[model samples]
Target: MLADRIPIADALHGKALELVHEHRAASVPLLERHLSIGPDMAEALLLRIARETTVVRRVQSGLYVYTHGPIGEELAALHGFAQEVLVALASNSVDVDQLRDAAGRYGFSIPHQAAGNATVAVPLCLAQVVNV
Candidate 1:
């Protein structure tokens, strides 16, 4: 029996795509470090993915931003919400109650039991963000 093997370039291309999706961003150094490939090959991989895939877009020199899919969408939404919260807070446009309501809409709520002991929840919230 004979088995088919994918060419090395194809394997690298697939792995590069996976790495970009997993990290939610991509760069030549990221590919080089994660794939253990030379700079030239890492750069070529990034160019190929940028040219061939729609999920990534070059935001600036040597930097690609993931702009689609579940993770990308969630991050984008969170960023927008954060900006809104910042602007509102800086202008004193919203009360604490209104801010809590807005945060609740984004799946965040102030724990009533953690009123003065907020330190205990900080690490847990950070872990959840990092895991996601």
Candidate 2:
């Protein structure tokens, strides 16, 4: 599985991935039009998608092509599982150590410093999906 190389704000990840998968490509203006965001945010989303995930590849200065297929689908599924782990961490519904071990099995690496404490660890882990 591809590492969560960069943090993609939760608010934008769904719509951004939607556009990429549906259109099989993305550009700054496309995101702005579809998401009603400004140029800066559109650019940020594009950069995050290109850098963080394997589903899309930067093909030009401001354009990315989604590499649609089994591999892309698999990576997307892994991302979904990662999100589930984050939810469990945030809700305090499960033990931190168990969640940590589960996350690692899926290739989601919790920072070493996050060990032991749920309060600190939850935010540290969630920082990957949202700004903290």
Candidate 3:
């Protein structure tokens, strides 16, 4: 059978996704019971699911939660920072320093790359923030 040809690890991951999305639960113990897997295997499969997809996140010790989106509607307000930064950029002909300050005021610290020791990096997070 083609389904039988699939490896157990991959099959476990698929079933786990189905269960999480269907039931809104990612309980390791539940998966262990359903799949006839022990705790260690269940833990490993859960870790694999997390690394391969964003559908599940460990919200507490030994507890996993299913997430429908990367960020929920409750965090809708946080996106304002990105929007505000974009507005400031669109409204200004500001220099690099001003841009950095504007982004900082919006609560973002742009990442910097160093070419030499003790050198401050460029505030290139400007591009990231705008895209955000």
Model 2 spans > 4 angstroms off: 1-8, 60-62, 70-132
Superposed model 1: Cα runs more than 4 Å off: 1-8, 70-132
**TM-score, ranked from best to worst:** 3, 1, 2
lDDT of 1: 0.62
| Pairs that clash in candidate 1 | none
Give per-residue CA lDDT, model 1, range 25-126, as digits (tens): 778789889999877776677667766766776665657777667765565556555665667757867455555555556655457644442211223543
TM-score of 2: 0.43
- Per-residue lDDT tens digits of candidate 3, residues 29-56? 8778887877776777666666576676
Candidate 3 Cα outliers beyond 4 Å, as residue runs: 1-8, 60-62, 70-132
lDDT of 2 by residue, 4-105 (tens): 344457878778889878887777778889999877777778777777777786664646667678767666656665677668768867555665665566
What would the TM-score be for candidate 3 when compared with the true structure? 0.47
TM-score per candidate: 0.44, 0.43, 0.47
lDDT of 1 at 4: 19
Worst 10 residues of 1 by lDDT: 118-127
Cα displacement (angstroms), candidate 1, residue 37, comes to 0.5
Model 2 has a clash total of 0
Deviation of model 3 at 110, angstroms: 16
Q: Relative to the true structure, how large is the alpha-carbon lDDT of every model?
A: 0.62, 0.65, 0.59
